[model samples]
Target: MAANGINSVALPPKDGFASGPLSPGEPAAPGLPLRSPNPLTSKVTSVLSTSYADAEFRDALGLLDERGLANSAETRRQLRLDIQKEVIQSNGDIITEFGRVADQLRRIGTTIDKLNRSYQEMKSHVTAAHKATSSTLDEASNLIAQRQDIEKKQHVLKALREHFVLSEDEEASLTLTSEPVDDRFFAILAKAKKIRTDCEVLLGFEHQTLGLEIMERTSKHLNQAFQKLYRWTQKEFKTLNLENPQINSSVRRALRVLAERPSLFQNCLDFFAEAREQILSDAFYLALTGTSPSGQEDRSVKPIELVAHDTLRYVGDMLAWIHSATVSEREALEILFVSDGNEIAKGIQAGRENDLWRLVTDEADGTPEFDAVKALNELVDRDVSGAARVLRQRVEQVIQTNEDTILAYKLANLLNFYRVTFSKLLGTQSVLLESMSNLETEALRQFRSLMRDHIATLQGEFQHTPSDLGPPDFLQESLKQLTSIMKTYETSLASTGDREADFQPVLAESFDPFISGCENMAKTIKPPSVSVFLINCLLVAKAALAPFDFTQKRVEALQSRVDEHAEKLVASQYAYLRTESGLDTLYDALAPLQATEEDIAKLRTSDALKPDVLIAASQNLDDFLPSALMDAMENLRHLQDSKLTRDITEEATEKFCVDFEHVEEMLISADEAIEQGQTNGHAGSQDGPQSLRALFPRTTGEIRVLLS
Candidate 1:
């Protein structure tokens, strides 16, 4: 730098002044100062040290003094002046660039001012354009809303047509003359009904012409469908083969729907029941006559009347045939009635509710309050009514003509058996059951009449009962017949609603008369044998009645009678003991005494009861005591039961012993009276001497041992 700028170090001897600064390490010229005048001045590296802001200053700074030492103050002052000149030159160039930028900024401001005025000119034209299109846009919007509303109304109209109108194919299924009545027919019929109902809702609107038209059309279709169902049901019923005991669901549903028209439904039922009745009546005639209703001989099955030659068998065969037919008929009809009985009830109930159903009903017909079970039972009863009538006639003839009371009861039991059977199959209110019941009552009446006439013959005749105190042969024979009748009744299937009440008349007619005859005969027997005879009769009656539940009270009554006669036997035996054992005289003496017997000491004052008489009676008792019980029992030996005889004997012996004790007490009182007289110095009061221990020597304990 010193070579390029001012050199403070002199060049070698260039006239004693530096033409150039020193190169490299050259010494300074003599007398030249090498020290900087301001030490900080040489320490300065550059005036434009951050030359990156202006790259032009970098070259200019290097051209200035790289002076290392100061020679004089004038030389340092020239270096300061050079640095100040460079700074002033650089500031002038920056000011010159600012002046060019200020010109360009003014030109841009002028351009922005002109564009702002042009935008103001376009604003009014755009607002005028918007104003011109507003009315057209409002009209277009109104047109779009109207178009959407019309499309919505079209959709609503399509839905209404589908809901209120039936297709031709669907209508044909219900109303077409050639269409068969079936499940599909019924389904379309039901749809027509629902549309008719929905039309009612449509009728609520102000303009109801559509509702009225659709309802009229649907009602016509419903009527046609129901008419088809009715004719189909009637046709099916005419050909119904009830042998299988089943009805199809289609036919069952048809019946349920047709029931809404009461006159039509009732007419169909009347025909079915009538056909069944005629068919069964013919079958019964064939069963009876061995010939068909058309007069052909039926060789396949034997005629019931021919096989059953006897009266009871003929009647039983008729009833059995009726029962079998009733079962088959009931089994076939239950599918229509009992199995779906509630459906019949509901159908009638619904018919009563429907105004449309009311229009078809005949006012004179009693069809509104129909009972399904009653209707079924009546129908079945009618079907077998012919057979039931024949059965009643045959059974009544047999029962009424039957002279044998036993056979009459057997017929009664047979009638009751069939009566119960028909009641179970048909019900208690059944006509067949009522006829059988009347027949049963007639048979029982015949039984009772025969029994009464037979009993009357025995009572009116003077036939002697056997001499042996026993039930007569007539009673035994009647009882045997009664037993046979009872066994037949026991096995019979008669209703046991109140068996005791029902059979009590039979007992009274057949049994009570014989018992009364026995009592009459017992009255003619000898007095001692009367109780034994009655006891024997009642015991026999009781044994016969013991095995049956219905005869429990009768058995109890017989037992009570037997016991009553047994009490009489016991009393007779006790009386015999009192007489035979000499205790009767002592009891006679003691009979008049007070209950406490305060006057017993004075009993010896009576001559009949004196001490010697008491000794005589006591002596007689001593003789009787050895075999007292034996003698008492021997008196009642004719009693049928040995146990009863023994029991009567013991009771009598105890009574005898009790009387002996009383006599001994009386004798002791007499002895004490004599002693009191003798101690008071009057010895005459001791009547003829006999001690109490000596007289009446037997004690009650001894008597009990002997009796046992």
Candidate 2:
């Protein structure tokens, strides 16, 4: 079995046959008795047996033996013959079975193809049907919506007609008067009438052509009634007397009734449309032309009386309606107030106030006019406090409802200027404060009104909550400027020896109400509470400084105490640290430090242990600390200067600047440590001098040589 075909076994000959040929060859070769095989032979036999018995070799040999037996010529020939016969029979059977299988597969494939075709056809049919159905449904829905809208319009028209009580007799008697109704009024009336008629026609068409089973005829009649009422309102306005005291009041009443419960009236649209024009015209004529055509002064009419009466009536009506209406309707009306009515009233009031003041102050001559000026000035001084109180009340009221009103902003701004002016008037001989107060008051009132209107409009349109009202950039700047002016005014007032005590109470009284109002309002606002607090603090500090004499050490000491308190308050309130660097790196590390108790405990034990950690902590408290401290110091310094002979402003400013710079320097050092730690990837860790030097590359080379 070896590849070389070497004989591996050596066997002894059979018994007594060992001699080569036992022949007469040279003395018979010794009969070599068969000797047992050598131990080496046995060993070789065992080795060969073991090697041949290997499973792999044995398997191969067995396979070879089977093949050899199978390939023997006799067996092979017979087997070949038998195999050829068997193969022929088997192939016949295979061919028969294959034909059967192929036929079955063909049938199955054909059936599947038919089913697939049917499924695709059905799916497409369903999809097409669904699309057609959806289209029909959408058309029906649109038609329903249109019908509903038409009905609503008709209903409104009917209500308008009933309210105006338009009759055939009145329509017949209507004619163009000497002072013809303006074309604008007529145009609006015509538009209202046309809208009514259009609704009637549409209703009729819906009934006749569309076969809509509804009360179309009744709706059409209602629309016609509204049209008549609209025409009557126009006629009434054309004949109205602006000079009659009762006329303005009546018109306002009518407008309110119409605006609030339009649904109750049969001709609501006609009434509203006509009334809108009439009210404006009447208001204008009453404002401008006080007398009638007879040339007698209209003794019965006063512009302020007319406007105040009408505006109050209008506001009352609106409020009543707001109370009665559904939440949604009330909201809608409120939006309208913000968008239209409030702004108009504010503008009219401002113009009226300006004109009245101008007339009252006619040329600065020193006779009765001078006396009048002085009296009015004194009156303004007295009334300014009252005005501030009223304004604060109004602001708080508006803020309390979680509602915005243009009136609120207007009031806030007006009060701000009034307070500032009052302080200035009490302090300086220069009329600058007085003039500024007047101008700023006017501006602030206007600004407040505008902001309120804007906020109201936004609230109405977006349904904004109280939290939505943020102090816009303009408002913030306005507030800041106002604060600055007040601060300056108070400083000036404090310096004036004659009126120092007088100004202090006035300033406190004026600002206390405003601060209180703002605080109350802040509950309903967003982040502005912080601003309110800061402003209040500023005002308090200013007021405190106003009465204290600068020359007295007691005043200075009191001021210092106030400053300290302010600084502490700011530090606690802001919870910031004073540092040179910004908080980015410090904050990032502090987050992880907080998660680890060991780090926090370490910080508590050793103040200087984690420079980065401390820096981070300090940064959080820094924002309020410096500003608060500065404000406190400024107040104290002002108090001292008031009592002293020195120029207080210059000294206070210098000290503030120096302290602020020191705060900045401290912040810088903390930031530097944080940055170093960040760069070295071991924030706030204590490192050896060498390691620290390596972390800070600039120090590396010098420190390395020293360490070596």
Candidate 3:
């Protein structure tokens, strides 16, 4: 032992051990057996063993603390000893626990080895099982994927069947059977049409046979359905009660559906028209004569013939009935034909008018169809044709038998009214419209004939013209008739074209002939009075006609005629004034002398133009001047218009003043020539006054004043 109290030291064995890393839960160093050899090696061993005792000494030294210092030596030593014993005992228990831990670790190692072996064994089984079932699992996955795809395909097929195929009952309702064309029928037809339309999508696919087959089947069904509707509609039309002009919904549906088939629709319209024609014909007879085709319809409403015994009223009532009937018929037809557009089959013949898509594509895969408005017009014309014929005969009969031109004119207006009404309701080329137009034309012809006959009678009766310069009685009566006729034209419904042009013929037939008759009657009136008579007649015509627009040209023409005759009257009045003033003879004598200066020189000494002759003419002028205006006015006193009398008097006076001025100039020239003659001593001394101023003392100024 060392002097410090370490007894022994532990060292490595003489066999020599290697130093390396330790395992888990290992001590810092392992125990080694010790053996003494040389003193040097023994010293290394002693030093090693002494290190263990040094640690114990260090702990024992710590036990000599503050408390330990106060303690007795024995107690302190005993405490150190207890501390060492406890340390040793605790280290022993630790060693014991470590040893038990080592045993458990060894057992755990064995179990782990068993577990790893079991794992090695089961891994091969798992691999083998996986290998065995891999294809089966893959097959199951593929089966699931295939099942999902099959479900999807099944869904698509179900949808396709619903889309492209009509059910059996729906098919039967549309084509196979004779059922009333109702909403159900229209519904089924609409479905069939949709199926056909959706087939276009089918056709877009590579397989188009399905689409083709569906389209073919649908087209056939549509044709058959339309044919049934057409025939049903036509048969229904045989008993169509147009008396109540409201259309039946079923009939309307049938017509709307049938319109999808244009040819069949047209045929149906023709059939309906034929049926209505007969029905309306009988209805017309009932209204006209209070007798049906069987002669047993209600006679409560008296015959139109009885109510309209007057010829104008008779034609008017008939035309009224026709117009009303045409309106009602058109309304019903519009209801039947022009409903809202079909969803599948548009009413387009080949294309919708204003459809922008129509430029790029033909939306209508259907056949050509007649326009609804056109077909409606055709039907209306045919339906009314029979009644129109009856009305025509009656109207022509009245126009022919009735001698009253005014009544005939009224009948013509009535026909024109209905004609225009029919044209609007049907069309301009409707047979009924054309017939009415013809009847109107005939009525006008009859009116003109009656007018001519009356004129002829008047011409035969009044062989001599009126003594007074006034409008003749026949002329006045003709003007009154013309005025009434013009009123009819003013209120007329049908304007052929330009207002002035259309009425030109009327003027030619009526007003022009009146003018001609007046001219013929005025022929017997001698000279001056003829102008006054024409003026009076023309003035009356202008006043009567100026108010109407269509007669504006006639009024203007009358004004021209009036002006013409007025000019003639003024001329005659001027001539009367000239003769009264004795300027007529002077003018005649001056006419030849005006050609040359030598003739002018001769005028002073000429017998016809001598100073004495000119003085005598002046004396006559002086006398005429006092009463010239009165005498001039007296010449036209027979003029019916006092205003016109004043106009003519003033015009005549102006003319006289002009002529007087001319006479004065020539007289002054003659006077100057006379003075020249006197200076040259050709005529020696002039007798009386030499200058015409002194000779014809009455100047043009004085004449104008007197006329004024």
- Model 1, span 244-332: residue lDDT tens: 66567777777677777777777767777778888888898899889998999979979987898887788878888888999888777
* Model 3 misplacement above 4 A: 1-168, 175-256, 260-263, 275-310, 342-372, 493-497, 591-600, 609-619, 665-696
Ranking by lDDT: 1, 3, 2
Model 1 misplaced regions, further than 4 Å: 1-178, 205-218, 283-291, 295-324, 338-344, 353-379, 417-427, 461-463, 488-497, 594-598, 610-631, 679-688, 692-708
Residue 149 of model 1, lDDT score = 100
Please provide, for model 2 over 1-708, each residue's C-alpha lDDT reduced to its tens digit, 9 standing for 90 to 100: 321111121112345443122233334346654433354565566666757655555654554465565555566455445544755787799999999999999999999999999999999999999987997989999999999999999898786454333344323222322222344333433444444445544456535432222234334434443444345444565665433434433333233323322332324333332453344334333433465434556666653324444432323332222222212222332332223454422422332322222213333442221222332233233322322333333334433432222333333333444345444433432232344354444534444454444434433323222232332333343344334434444454233564445334333333333333444554553332343333334444454444444323323544565455444433332222223223334333333443234553333344332445444444443443345434433433322223321233233334433343433433344445545656689757565322211222222232122212
lDDT of each candidate versus the true structure: 0.74, 0.40, 0.74
How many clashing pairs per prediction, in order? 0, 37, 2
- On a 0 to 1 TM-score scale, where does candidate 2 land against the true structure? 0.18
Model 3 lDDT per residue over 1-708, tens place: 121221111122335542222344554445653333354665566456755446655543454443335556566455555545765787799999999999999999999999999999999999999999999999999999999999999999999888778778777887755666678888888888888888899899999998999999898888888777777787788877665656576776666555555467657766777788887788888999887878686858689998887777888888888887787777776666565463112443333332211112244654333345665677677888888889888877887888888888888877777777777777776788788878888988998898778767776635556778677777788789888988988888746467778878777777777777788878877778999888888998898899988778778888998899888888888789878888888877766556357877666566766677877887887887888888888888889898888888888878777766776787777677657666777565546345667767777777778889
Query: What pairs collide in candidate 3?
Result: 9-49, 10-49
Choose the strongest candidate by TM-score.
Answer: 3
